[model samples]
Target: MLYYFSLCNILLLYLILISLTFLMLGFYFIMNGIIYFIEYELFMLNGSQVIMTLLFDWMSLIFMGFVLFISSLIIYYSSEYMSGDKYLDRFIILVLMFIFSMMFMIISPNLISILLGWDGLGLVSYCLVIYYQNIKSFNAGMITALSNRVGDSMLLMSIAWMFSYGSWNYFMYIDFFSFNFDVKIIGLLIVISAMTKSAQIPFSPWLPAAMAAPTPVSSLVHSSTLVTAGVYLLIRFNPLYLDSSLSLFMLFISLITMFMSGFCANYEFDLKKIIALSTLSQLGLMMSILSFGYIYLAYFHLLTHALFKALLFMCSGVVIHSFKDCQDIRYLGNLYIQMPLTCICFTISSLCLCGMPFLSGFYSKDLILELYSSCYINMFSYFLYYFSTGLSVSYSIRLIYYLIISDFSFYCYHSIYDEGWIMLKGMFIMVIVSIFGGSMLMWLLFPTPYLVIIPFYLKLMVLLICLFGGWLGYMINKFNLYDIMINLNYNNLCSYFGFMWFMPYITVKISYIYLLMGLKLNKSGDYGWFEMLGGQGLFYMLNDFSLKNQNIQNNIFNLFYIFISFWFILLFLM
Candidate 1:
């Protein structure tokens, strides 16, 4: 029975998994620059064969190692965060499934095997997102599941599209396929699939909505597993689409996603949702960098992001749980005193998120910016890149102001403690990683690097933007700028920012209008007119004929005699 399964056991199991993963990781590191493949034939049809395959390379193994490490830490953190909850066992199982699915995705290079992991992620994530038996969780789950399903379907279609090539392993043809029209279509579909998975542009509403899940799920999904899956896939698929026009489209869409999420995070109030939006922003950053032909830089950022974002989520969980499950930032304050350890962890992660000098986020973010500046890009694109980078600082500072700097808005009499040692234990590991992971990964992954030649003014642009954004953030919160706008009859403008520039509204309106039209068409065309013209129409006509024929059957003998007599009389008269 679950009574026998305790939180301690879960942590112990995670510890075991962590040890094994580290062992494998060490082995893989020693074997770096080497590719190992294990394959076995599962079946054969005509000239085609189905095989089970696992590919072990530096990238895949390192990513898997990091994923396992973060997952184990998150599980350990959840021990405290989810303690006393009745459904803790189920939650643990869901987390395990999530981690396993991510591993499955990471190790497989075949499209067919990848789909197994892809769909598993979508299905398991839906279960996790709706873990709470509430209307909000249900709605969030529906949106999350439906949005991800679009990606899943696109992936499946792409798999079918690959049938012409007679192989499921995309790794083999990385540079073999020519950039023809058909190849472009497949590439386009794959990019769209990645966009949905990464929460780019129109697909972004689901990421914030998915904050309805428990903090652990949010940590896992937003950090190492679900959202990053798309970036990972694109990195692996990058060889095939290096020169495709679709990459240009992705570049713009990713920039927009980055800009939108960064600005929205500044306006958001819920602590978890703000963090979630930041994850979206970073995912966009990774995608945009990847689109710029910096796949390794993007991958480097993805790994570093997973480290700090997971820790950030875990810290937010502590704060939210301490505040009696209150998540609104408006009610949070003075955490630096009440929950010193948690606040410190949160601060480190927030600074890292802002790309503070020498932090984990700075390594990859700085390199990406310098490369972007040195590249021959237009003025508009450069502005979007720098502006979005600044917004990251803005939101990070805004979050810090509300949660740590201001006075506590919660009830004064309630006691708050920073005593969740288990949660803190998990966060402590990430604290080190958040500080050093970026630099370490940068050195390990890119032993040889390009010397980026950016102008001095552009080199200092990030610093200037951070300072300005930080000041704006402080002013906005310190003087109650949002309230001032409301008081001065700028409610419309405030609403737009608060509602993410009406993105959610647009998504809801489009979904509602189309759904209504579909229902009306079904009612009128399928159920009403079509049914009448097809099955019901035929049934009614046959039924009426049968009823009239029944009357004729009853009078058949009498009618025949009457007809014969009338014919005889007519003949005699003639």
Candidate 2:
């Protein structure tokens, strides 16, 4: 036990040291406007070089810093969370592998290298998701793996397409060949790949389903690493596709994803799933902003969201741990009475999610909304964006009410307490960053402030929507038997909204069809058709033929014996 504890501390220290180093380097690079690229040529084929490249831009370095920092804190928290688990060491190794995979993905400019990291993330995430070894975890892991495989396939196709360009280092030719047909195809493929990784629109269900993983993995994966890989990829490829029609398509898809996820989060009851849905909504916001060609703003929000979201998950983990693994929010009430520190951190993170004034989310979310308003988008998109923002606040307020404001809903006899010091230590660090990480990142990422010249009504719209949304959330929790009956009348509608508009069902059905096909193929190819036509069928045919020949020989022997007996009788009579 002590060895495991020491192992966690050592890992935590190393990750933190590396994170600080990366962060300092990132700051220096940003300050000096320096971009360094290091390349190692592995070999050449047909004059097309295959080189492993690492990019040391402010973006990659800072993102890496954030990833490692969050990873370190999560690891420390997990030391306490998974203290009793027998496979704690295995868990730690998997997490370290995940961190390394993320680092590789963050720094690599080569498509081939990116795929290696990308595939590693998908594979490791699958392993982590099924860590609990239950049916649900297994299902969740399968869904996570298969869904990500789509993105992997897309990325592989993009790599194959890029082979025509003589080098897979996309950074070298993306801008130069921005208007080329092959480049456009590669861009489209990359967009699809990013969509799958980021869980956009049709691909959104996996994010919430991935909640089957442990809370610490949840904090790390959902916050800054796995899900954000798609947005990061798009940000890297922003120069190539920002001017194309793909950006417009991405805009619509991202807004709908934002609206859908925010709406679903309100209807969700599971604590982790709610947080996961919120992550989905935030990812949509990032993708939407990226689609609008504001790359830095998207990146800024990504960093800030990572801080608060991780804190949110950490606090939820504490609550769930104290509740003896009860994740249904209805059973969790008055947590503030038992876990005051955790409740405080949870409330702060929830408010940050709501874009409350001066919070981390406010800086980035406000800027994104303001910049979105300033854009020349359609009114439909405008409505979706603001409405989605309101829904975010709605769900957040609803969660806070269920967890902290309401009376205790658990059993009469319960022993819920905030006892994990190491977990609290981790949450404490995140809380500080969740409060101030936004403004700090904002100033550093964008040295020049963006100018927005929107009307007063437009600016005031956000405040009004937030207030209205909060009121709606409070009302939602105040439902009586009458409201329940009224909702029952709209059961299908409620289920549709609650189930992420049946996106999971769609994914399941698609997978089910493939599984069914595979079953049929296995039966026909291996058992039915092949069995009849191959060795088994030949053996049966040969056995029957030999049996017939033996029967014929037996009949011939019987006839000869009859003749010999008849001849012997005749000879004796003579």
Candidate 3:
């Protein structure tokens, strides 16, 4: 009975969240949306099979708890940041819908339930991104939809393959404990889905485009909650990825994404955009580490990342809100003096981002490195981890340096004193947890003595690397990283890199090659090769007729046909 409640009670949480959001919108009648947090024992059900579960598991508890906290903070900050806007009605509806999808996603009992929530959130997030309905943001919004659809199709195929092992039952995940029956194919497809969602290589470019959203939006969904769904899915599938060739692939992609995004972060001048790029890098690092067999470490990083990242983004939003009309890092600085509390919050969180010692990220990120070195692992992966950590430290230092360096250049600073105290209060809550987050978290998870190993060496090394990154930035900015950009394109350059670069040229190139090959074949004699094999397609026709004439009548017999068709169509990627 209690197990069943998890699936159903989330609907109640949705109802209350939506109702309160609506009520708050009515009261404000501007752009404010309400946020509510409620907790109860939640049930999880998967059709007529594998119907009950209650999670005392450390991973599930930590993931869900962080999701709840960051989500609440984003909404609270949004109420003020979005004050006196025009899209209040529409924005609230989408926010409620987004929350609903996240809830459904976390509680999904079976892969099917998970997919439903996954796709629902995808659609809702696209709507939120295009809520402004301007010419350019909407187009960026469409690109996000297209890339996500391609990945979702892959996930759907993986689910179909899992069903094929026996039936459309997920309790049998335990039964799928090996790499037999072409499991790597589905595993690869699933990783494609995860990579896209987590904003990894090739697919990572969408996340910065998603920055067209409102600041609080970038804070909550993009930085904290939505993108993290990919990691959550990979973690959920730990049983399948436990020991396989597929895990190596996941690790490789993750390493590349981490280093690439870290380099790109230097070029991002927009505060929100820098954070967006950093989130992509950090998430890739987490997933790569997890794939290499550190489940607890992965979840720990995910949990800690959500808190500090949300805090940083929200604090950036506060900076933008106070500036009255500033958007770029150049137009804003000395924010430390102007918004001292916000600056303090941002600084602590920023250090956390660099994985400074005793901060939460330090413990989590270092443990994975510890595990990575424990065995004579892939030498390449081991070095990549070190390289990735250094870059992470670099960009984190970059955000603090230029952001505080020159002094506030705001044309008119509004002097925001935590206008939305509720949101500030929420962020402060995370900050408190974040400052002592390492100690408390370790205490909760491990025994007392072993928890004491997170140390000064890791902390000092990261901080020293960060200081060097800041020095490098001071020189790079003085010489100008792209002296050409500041001298020329400026805002246009921002639009070009941040938005235009991700257009699907690969898809177009593939299609062009396919068409060219067909044309060349027809010009020669190869076009008729199929005709020689089947003589005007009669071969498949005969097979079809013979199968139809057999007159299969059993329900189980027909079920396999439907199942196979679903899998084939799903696996049919160009």
- Poorly placed runs, candidate 1 (over 4 Å): 1-31, 45-48, 534-556, 563-574
lDDT tens digits by residue: candidate 2, 1-574: 8888899899899999999999999999999999999988889999977677999999999999999999999999999999989989999999999999999999999898999999999999999999999999999999999999999999999988876787777778766774778777888999999999999988888899899999999999989899999999999989767888999989889999999999988888899999999999999899999988999889888899999999999999999898889999989888887889999999999999999999999999888888888998888989999999999998998999998888789999989888999999999999998998888887887888888899999898878888888888888886632248456797777789889999999999999999999999999999998888998999999999999999988799788999999999999999
| Candidate that beats the other on lDDT, 1 or 3, i.e. the better one | 1
Model 3, C-alpha of 214: deviation from truth (Å):
1.6
Model 3: residue 236 alpha-carbon error in angstroms = 1.6
Q: Which residue pairs overlap in candidate 2's backbone? A: none
For candidate 1, what is the TM-score?
0.92
Instruction: For candidate 3, write residues 377-451 as lDDT tens digits.
Output: 666876676676777777776677766766666666356455656457757877897878676666555543333
Best of the candidates, lDDT: 2
Taking the tens digit of each residue's C-alpha lDDT, what string does model 1 give over 140-159? 88888878989999999999
In model 3, the clashing pairs are: 5-43, 6-42, 6-43, 7-43
> Which pairs of residues have clashing backbones in candidate 1?
none
Ranking by lDDT: 2, 1, 3
Worst lDDT 10-window in candidate 3: 29-38
* Candidate RMSDs in order: 2.6, 4.6, 15.7
